[model samples]
Structure formats: structure tokens, C-alpha cells
Target: MKARFPDRAKLRAQVWNAMDNNPGTRMPAFGKYQALSEAEIDAIVDYLYTL
Candidate 1:
């Protein structure tokens, strides 16, 4: 199996703290984040299952 990332809350925190170009989302916009596509979100379901 592939390596799993962090959990939902954890992932959200990570993404929130990460780089997000969108103003409506993310706290800090200057790390490693962007508008995640539907497929990408699907792939990260485990990480965002709670939301």
C-alpha cells in the first residue's frame, strides 16, 4: 500500500498553514497548498474524510 498522509484535522491544519493562493481559504498563503481538484480531493479522501 502507499504511504498515508496525516488525518483530516491534521491535513486541514497543514493545508491551512500551507501556501494557498485563494483568499477565501487557507490562513497563510505561501507554503505548499493550492486549489485542490475534485480528483485530488478524492485521492485525499482519507485525509479529509471528516469534512
Candidate 2:
């Protein structure tokens, strides 16, 4: 099967952007998450790799 997120860096960027920007209809903008730092976001991305 095709991969959901083939590029980790791209995925991280998308996630960070989604925090303030609306990605799509399925998910709403999570502006509150903007408080998270780049390191925190990287940690999140690292966790996602496990899934």
C-alpha cells in the first residue's frame, strides 16, 4: 500500500501549519496549539513515526 506520510519533514511542516491553519473539512484549526514550540512539534512528529 502507499504510505500516508512518505516524508517526515513534510509531515512535520503540515502538522505545524495545521495548528493555525485549517487543513481540511475533517479537522478544524487548532490555533491554541500554536503555543507549542518547534521542539514540541518535532517530538510529536517523532511519536507519529511509531504509529
Candidate 3:
């Protein structure tokens, strides 16, 4: 979710935090992503930034 926003690091951190918090159906639970490693998460974040 690319936005006109300036802080990619902050945005990335928010995503990571949300994943850790597991906020139910409001977003996907991070546990479903246990198979993914930190590098995979970084790659996903990088791709989102390109949008």
C-alpha cells in the first residue's frame, strides 16, 4: 500500500507491529505467516512500497 507518505521505515515498522499484535480479522494474523522468515517479510514490504 504505497501512499504519498514519506516514511517507509515507519510504515514497515507499523506493519511488523500489527503482525505481532495479531489484531484478529481486521487484518491477517501473523501466525499464518510463521512459515515466512524476516527476509520474506522485508521483501513483501519492499514490494508494497513499489505500489
Candidate 4:
């Protein structure tokens, strides 16, 4: 997690920021860039669960 395990709220915000706030933005730090990154998501989820 690198000491940055963002919570559900943060995750939602990232997704929203990419979809709404940015609208036309690409390479977003959220899901779009990481949308297909199930490995990353799973890793983060696992780390967050420990906290």
C-alpha cells in the first residue's frame, strides 16, 4: 500500500474526479487509468483491509 491505502471515500472520489470533475481527462489517477487493474485494486484492497 506504500502507506497510502485510500479508503472507499477516496476511491469514489478518484473515480468521480476522473468521470465528473475532469470529464475529458485521461491517464487519471483513479479507476479509468486503473480501471482494468484488478491486480492493483486487489492489492490495495488487501492492504486497506489490514488497516
Best by TM-score: 2
lDDT of 2: 0.62
Please write out the lDDT profile of model 2 over residues 1-51, one tens digit for every residue: 017778786677666665333445354232235657778778878888888
Candidate 4 lands at a TM-score of: 0.35
| lDDT by residue for model 4 (1-51), tens | 325534555554544344555666674554455554656665665555577
Q: Which stretches of candidate 4 lie over 4 Å from their true place?
A: 1-29
Best lDDT goes to which candidate? 2
Off by over 4 Å in 3: 19-25, 29-35
Where does model 1 exceed 4 Å of error? 1-3, 19-51
The residue-level lDDT of candidate 2 at 5 comes to 79
Model 2, residue 46: C-alpha shift (Å): 0.3
lDDT of each: 0.46, 0.62, 0.60, 0.53
Instruction: Point out the higher-scoring one by lDDT: 1 or 4.
Output: 4
RMSD of each: 8.7, 4.0, 3.8, 5.6
Kindly indicate the candidate among 3 and 4 with the higher TM-score: 3
- Estimate TM-scores for all models: 0.26, 0.60, 0.50, 0.35
TM-score between model 1 and native: 0.26
Evaluation by TM-score, superior candidate among 1 and 2: 2
Q: Which rank order by TM-score, best down to worst?
A: 2, 3, 4, 1
lDDT for model 1, please.
0.46
